[model samples]
Target: MKKLLFLVFALGSSCFLFAQDETVQALKKDAERTIQKDPNDTTSKTWKTGGFVGINAAQGSLSNWAAGGDKFSLAVNGNLSLYAFHKKNKHTWDNTLDINLGYINTTSLGSRKNDDRIDLLSKYGYAIGPKWNVGALFNFRSQLFKGYAYDDDGNRTFNSNFFSPAYVLLSPGVEWKPNNEFSAFISPATVRWTIVKNDSLAAVGAYGVDPGKHSRTEFGAFASLNYMKEINKMFSYKSRMDLYSNYLKNPKNIDVYWTNMINMKLTKFLTLTYSLDLIYDDDVKLFGENNDSPATQIKSMLGLGFLVKF
Candidate 1:
């Protein structure tokens, strides 16, 4: 009877120890799953970098054909966009660059530029909540080459050159980013500087600068919205809008800058793209057939091109 009792006690102790070991292993696995990071979390990425480049071209040649058109013509457009972002913990940094240039040549019109742009932006943020951040942003916008306004008589007037009307802004703001596809920044105090470094442009007070002055400064309320989304496997769209109200000048006449891009992917390297831009500034004047006034400017482009991604 004593030996049987000893055996029973040993078996019971072994069974209890085995069951406790299984429970511990299950708990460990559960903890690991809870703490493991998700691969698709955009906010937690350490670094992300990518860009796209595209070129579109068109040409036409006519001999003795009856069609009434330029004997020879060619048009080419090129664009580049780049971005880099870093995010970790509660801090984030983003930078972007964009450029576009286009030219058209024809027997009747010679060579002229159809599009020109350069834009750069950088932002830094510290997250205060799940969807809110305290942020500071810097932006610069200008053209790459000289721009001209041609009249009906084929006479051209020099309008702009590099740095002739560069726009720079620094904003301390609050940002809301609830998802990967949308972000908005709002600032009560934004500093804007318009620079016209060219002597000719400065003499005429181009782009709202004081006469004979190379730059103008403004304090304003500013807001910006950025949204990007992939509609499906073959279609995507992105847009940006900026609004500014100058407190030192005419606050009621707001300045606006808006851009939109739509892309349709045909293959891995081929795409059809459309881009639109709209700008309006109260201090800038546009010469029209009737009078010179502050008017909204619009530009749009559509083309099929080969795209390269990096």
Candidate 2:
């Protein structure tokens, strides 16, 4: 009878252990699912950061082709962009910095700059309504290196250098953001400054600064529209346009800057990109094939490249 009781007790203990093991396994899976559903627990993410780097290249060689072209030509370009966004409660902040620099070598022109750009934008906002906010915006733009204009004879004339024609803008504004992909900011009170740090360029009154002076200031009204969207899994686009009218000077003449970029993903690390940039500044002069006046400046680039995103 004692043996029988011992056997029964052992059987009961084994069943209890098996049941406990099953319960533990079930709980483990449930905890994992809960963690997956709420990766950050009850708190929402407050900061997001991402950027991309791209490199593009092209080359051509001709030995006996009927078409007239350089015997050998090669171009390589690189671009980098970084962005950070923060949101908590009714406060939001966004920032972006972009840099582009590239070079080209050809039989005709040897080596020259193919691209140069630097842009920075920052904005902070407090929500006044669901889709509207009171905000402050800041922008800075310059170049990384000296740029030159080359004539047909391959003679070069200095055009711009680092900080030689830098621009700064600050504004307190109302911003309307209907969605994550679009925003419009308008400000009646804005300040703009233009700086030419190069003594030679400053002496020539380049970029509207007074001759021999290194800086120019203006009070203005400003407006800007920014848009970014991924059209599909393979395509994306971004654009921004800025307009400013100087209240202290010619209020009727407005300065404009617009930029657009499009990307088509060909593979995980390959992309085709196209970019367009336009600027119109009343104080700046542009010489074109048929016009030497203050014409609208335009630039376009298209290439297939390797892209990395994070």
Most accurate candidate by lDDT: 2
Best by TM-score: 2
Full-model lDDT for every candidate = 0.91, 0.92
Tens-place lDDT per residue, model 2, 75-140, is: 898999899999999999999999998899999889999789899999999999989999899999
In candidate 1, which residue pairs clash?
none
RMSD value for candidate 1: 9.2
Model 1 TM-score (2 dp): 0.84
Off by over 4 Å in 1: 1-45, 65-67, 289-291
- Which digits, one per residue and each the tens of the lDDT, describe model 1 over residues 90-206? 999988899999999999888999999999989899999999999899999999999998887778888898988999999999999999889999999999999999999899788
Per-model root-mean-square deviation over C-alphas: 9.2, 3.9
Where does model 2 exceed 4 Å of error? 1-41, 286-292
Point out the worst 10-residue segment of candidate 1 by lDDT.
283-292
Model 2: lDDT of residue 186: 98
